[model samples]
Target: MTDAPFQFFDVEVLRTERLTPAVARVVLGGASVSRMASAGRDQRVKLFLPHPGQREPVLPDTERADWYDAYRELDPAVRGVMRTYTVRELRGEAGELVIDFALHGDEAPAGAAGATAHDTGADVHGDAGTASGPATRWARAAGPGDRISVLAPVQEENGGYDFRPPEGTDWVLLTGDESALPAVAGILESLPPGLPTRVWIEVHDPADRQDLPTKADAEIVWLVHGTSPTTTEAIRAAELPAGTPYAWTAGEAATVKALRRHLVGERGFDRRAVKFSGYWRRGASEDSPMSAADAEEEA
Candidate 1:
């Protein structure tokens, strides 16, 4: 591992599965995966994918102190395609890491047959839309034995996640779209039993709803994009548990912002008590330039 807070790990896809209509799960395995440690809830990692026609990603030299600067200097078209994703589960015993991708952009046909590990370069069917991003394309086409690289934490106490509930908190609130499902699931799994927890998840399709298993006394409500009320609307209408509440919300930038404002401004929640993140904006790709305000929210 490098001497930095994050280390680069080369991995191969051990397997992949379509979890839901909008979510795909990739199980990655490599000798290096055994040494990687995650802080669990909402742990973020930088995934580097090879460009089309390349077998593996071209990454910056790990020995360098300023690896990110070196990466930025490389040719964009040839260098690795980097995107941030959550570590859904880290199974050290199995030497594997799991990541779930929310299918977006131009997607493969609903009935299309996915290629197997042996068929590495099969043509995928779908309409090519301007909104399609490399990450979305890569996830849809990824197969077993496919190569990728990740920048992950080597320590358990790494501050790469943001699901801390302060002491004296009586209840918890979690909300997000499919983009934030992995994080919400992780948080739910980590909560103590009998803790009063409320969740509001929004997804484009009802089939995207996941069976989130948690030990906590959690009340989860799924909101289909066109069929159900918005997260803010659901939260506003429901009666919340008494006492100090810790809230975590993520998804589209505008939706996250609206939820945060409602919690802090209208509901009288302490600004610091609510941990929110904008996983993506409605029409913008991750490569889009972020404004100062967006950077602040992400930070």
Candidate 2:
């Protein structure tokens, strides 16, 4: 499965740590992760989380091309929730994979553009896994030694990764809401120390702003919920740096579209040079039945 685009790997929770008030880091270990050569920045993996009660989720047959269709055929009640997540960090040497989850607990504020944020991204339980989202709720409660399934990209052709800034760009603009933070952090870590960048990250609370490691000449801007503007609005109003600027933006579907329009339509930025993704839509949960193609951006 070295070069296979799709592969299933069983991973066990080795440990967990709280990264911020509304975020937790879970480390998983497995042989497959150790041998993985290069996980592109912003790599997207599908997680098969255990449903409400059952542990040791029923495994799926991933060898066939119709794996997803077959998965859809399973009994809805027994079929676990499949959510997409960004790989926050992958330590190939230690066989550890880190994933940062944006906790949407009961007290967490509502999301942007009418997203599923609750009470300013704070959970009344003061812990993860109490949000309305099944993934968040589960992640908050997940612990060490627990088990789950992951369908990861194998660094093959046309992989599921998202980070791909065009070649020869003078500077970069990285902006997104919390959902995009994991990928944004991965991208920042992989960047060269010399590249200049303007980064805008919006979170519900200041505590949600985790340490972002980057050596690039980054003018980092942190946006707090009540005091700051929306991610799209702030980024749209920002002045782009001199020279050819490549922009990568993500977050709510509506917000992403608005930002893209401002960059290309209003600012006259080249469409092909801008990259964007809709991590989620307004009023939609992580498992919302949204068409993947719905996220349109500059080609």
Candidate 3:
């Protein structure tokens, strides 16, 4: 196999499930899926979704290094919709991959396409059309046999896997909003057994809370929207474990910066020991130019 860091693969939706009030799980399976590998924690993948009328996403030649540029040159309405998402799990033996999507505040409308054959009745919580982006809408209405494309790593050591707790680390600190749940879950599941860990997750509703099974001795806190404090505030006010620590934070760009600032400035954490990412920024679409949070995280 080629040693490229990432490659494109065409996959089809094998099934879909409602994991929580705001999260939908889509299982994709195809011949190409067997060749994909994930490094687990916070493994990033770029997914290409077809427009409503398109049979499959229209992508540029995958072999070209500048395929992204080629894709950008295409007419927006004629090109595929792209989104970044974390893989919840990879079932290699079964040739399947799972991705969990946050539905935001919208649910699939009744009588939508393929509702009868593959609808799991999972998109039942929020009103349709509220805060629903292309990905959200696609997830809401996605069904078995729906086709898509993904650019993912075939090897585990690719730069896409970012959560790395160095040796000698005594404990871990994790914070994120709903978007980071899958990454956090993957990290928790893969942590060394009996390690000290703390997690704070913010979600739109109590029903969005997921049962994350992990071997680490973890204390998890769920911060609900409007009821609980923001992720930064919650982590800031709490006392953390006394030891060499490694922290990872993701979610809204601004909030992620706040958490990183608090950890490094107020909490006296080594800047390098705290890894952060902004999965998204408020008031911005996924396709928008990088924001300050993106620069801050890189810094």
Q: Count the backbone clashes (under 3 Å) in each candidate.
A: 0, 19, 0
- Work out candidate 2's RMSD over C-alphas: 4.3
lDDT of 3 at 142: 92
Q: What is the C-alpha lDDT of each candidate?
A: 0.77, 0.70, 0.77
lDDT of 1 by residue, 1-299 (tens): 45566888999999999998667899999998988999898898888889999999998896688887899889988999777788999999999999987665445334222211002211111111234457667888999999999989999888788899999999999998776888999999999999999999987777778999999999999997767998999999999999999999876666788889899999999998999876665333334455323633652
lDDT-wise, the better of 1 and 2 is: 1
Tell me the deviation in Å of residue 39 in model 2.
3.2
lDDT of 2 by residue, 237-288 (tens): 7776888888898776667788888889988889888888877654344333
- Candidate 3 residue-wise lDDT, 134-162, digit = tens: 77778888999999999899987888877
| Candidate 2 off by > 4 Å | 1-3, 107-131, 156-158, 285-288, 297-299
Regions more than 4 Å wrong, model 3: 108-130, 291-299
lDDT, candidate 1, residue 154? 90
| lDDT at residue 47 of model 1 (Cα atoms) | 86
Please give each candidate's TM-score: 0.90, 0.87, 0.89
Which whole-number lDDT from 0 to 100 does residue 135 have in model 2? 64
